[model samples]
Target: MIKRYTELADAVEHLLLEKNSEFICYLQPVTSREAALQWLAQYRQQYSDANHVCWAYIIGNTRQPQTQAFSDDGEPSGTAGKPMLHVLTERELGNCLAVVVRYFGGVKLGAGGLVRAYSNAVSQAAGNAELRMISPSVQLSISVSFAFEARLRQLLQQYQAALDDVAYRDNVSMQVSVPQDAEPALREQLINETAGAAVIRQVASHSGV
Candidate 1:
């Protein structure tokens, strides 16, 4: 299952040297092939003078990936793209892209050196990135007698849940979102506390986000 992911909110830099040449790795989060390619194009435009704008990207879940692509630009065939892709996969990051821009510094690092430099760039970016996880959730709606409003509010607080679309006419009707696993217990508490007077309906199933 795809549970957690690490992504960058903005581009991050990893700088290194190999025989005086400069390799800068820029890591950005992207959700689709189009976005990944757009990142590559934007980098190319921003670094128009760069010697090679090699890139690698995975477009979905790391474990069950949906799409992937890479390009070496003008660098050695397997040096830049393959190495960058390797770093991202090993880090178990999904829905992100990696672009490595090389500036010619009057130095020529051979195939092995290029691989090391490119991989190191991506590794450095990964090391400096911020990681976030998906939280499980459920959506529900509740209707209850006006007299039970304050009481229901207190019960929801127990689960750190809150009513979102509360309305008052004859009684109270509102929407709430809570932790997925807490739904059963929350329901039980409402029914028991109200002596079966509370009406609860689930609007959405458990989801990870």
Candidate 2:
């Protein structure tokens, strides 16, 4: 599954503001549904005086799932939460929490206007903040004779594998991070380049940041 690439934030004026109605959007990084819920609680307390708190979250690294919650605090039901959640899920973002707090003015926006306002708030926040993608990666460790260390390093660089660590001795021990899909090709290239003189080990799988 594809992951979110960056976090962003933006703001827009409410289309039907009577007197100083304000909406504040908060975006944060979250790894699990529990974390997202905790964030929702915290923001609810932090903005206790606001009229409404609406939130949405996408969780999991791959095959992500989505959850959303909202309180009108007196506004019409079904007007605030669903639209905000829609924005998050539509973008296929994961491990993230988005909340919009509203302070109502004397004027009343119809159901349609409420949906537009809440959705617009989240869309603006997502658009302006920075985001990052999380991908699956694997680490490969290799030991090579000193004579072949330079060639190995060059080959790793050519493949754009991140050199995690290196140790120098009679043989060189190097750790490299490669995309999960590319691990087999990397292993073959290393074996061929060192002419079977190198011993390679699969270290561990990691989430690529």
Candidate 3:
């Protein structure tokens, strides 16, 4: 999965100095397509007079329902947008938007230069930002009798589980976020800890931000 930040990333205002051309790349975190579009609009106004405002965004996880968009902004069709999108896809980055604004210098860069420039801009920006993994988490409600409450709390602490709610009835209901992969292990542990007394059930699963 593509993370928001990279441990070691490089940043530069312009990649090519000889051509007198300048490129500004901005890497922003965006959750939805609307947010991505809004960021594009904001940059459009910020660099209204620039020659090109090319951009791309990846929203969602690696599995499914991932949304992506790109625009060449008057550059050769597919030259700018597709290249930018390629960088995002190849890097496996999601929930992020990258905008590359170029102020055309006197000289013209061929199609190859254009593609390389846009792709490099994004890659460099990604390098400069920190990247982290956001895994899928599930909340499970576990019930235990008051007799086992103290031991249950100790087990929860050992597992680094969070208590969502509690009831003073004969049993206590506690909710905890468990990693998807660790759910089975957690369930087994809980069962063994409670000696089949406490029952653990999944309440919900979601991708955390």
Candidate 4:
């Protein structure tokens, strides 16, 4: 499991020129394949005159991404998009996309030159973008009687869990988000402190940016 990883804080771009060819690289934070594609469409529209719009993305966990895809557009196979993706994975960047727009400058760079151009386009530009750590998390719903409400709250605080929601009725129902790595210890503490009276149900898991 990816306990922590880096992701772009915001969109960034860099331009490189190699052998009279222009390569403009754009790096942005994206959560899913759909989001990456949507951005790709927008960039294509924005740079409609570009000769090529190559792109790559790694969504979700960096160590083991939930989704990853790339396109070389019209460039030679494995020359453009793959090299850009290599730079992203080498940096262990998750939930991000790198798109390169090229303008033909009437110069033909060989495959090796193309790869270096695309790779450097991203590697150099990424230094200008802000990045932050992401911690994967799990959300759980806990139900307990009023008698154990205070103890449950204390346990949640002890584990640095985020109290998402709470409701009072015949019993106290609370929704909380906890770091994935600490879920087991928190669960055990809840069971012990509430004397097994707390009912915990996993709601969903996500990355805590």
Highest TM-score against the true fold, candidate: 4
- Model 4, span 119-202: residue lDDT tens: 999999887888888888899999999988888888888888999999999999999999999999999988887778889999
TM-score of 1: 0.69
User: How high is each candidate's TM-score?
Assistant: 0.69, 0.71, 0.80, 0.89
Worst 10 residues of 4 by lDDT: 1-10
Cα-based RMSD of the predictions, in order? 4.1, 4.3, 3.8, 2.0
Each model's lDDT comes to 0.81, 0.71, 0.74, 0.90
Query: Per the 3 Å backbone cut-off, how many clashing residue pairs does candidate 2 have?
Result: 15
| Model 3 C-alpha lDDT per residue in residues 108-185, reported as the tens digit of each score | 888888888888888877666666566666789888887888887877676656677777776787887866666777
lDDT of 1 by residue, 1-209 (tens): 23345444456778877777888888888878998888888999999998999999986666667798889998879988998888888986677799888888887778998899999989988888875554446788899998888888888889877567898878899799877767789999999989999899989754345
Best by lDDT: 4
Greater lDDT among 1 and 4 belongs to: 4
TM-score for candidate 2: 0.71
On a 0 to 100 scale, what is the lDDT of residue 94 in model 2? 55
lDDT of 2 by residue, 72-126 (tens): 5555777777777777766644566778888887777789888888888777766
What is the lDDT, from 0 to 100, of the residue 108 in candidate 4?
88
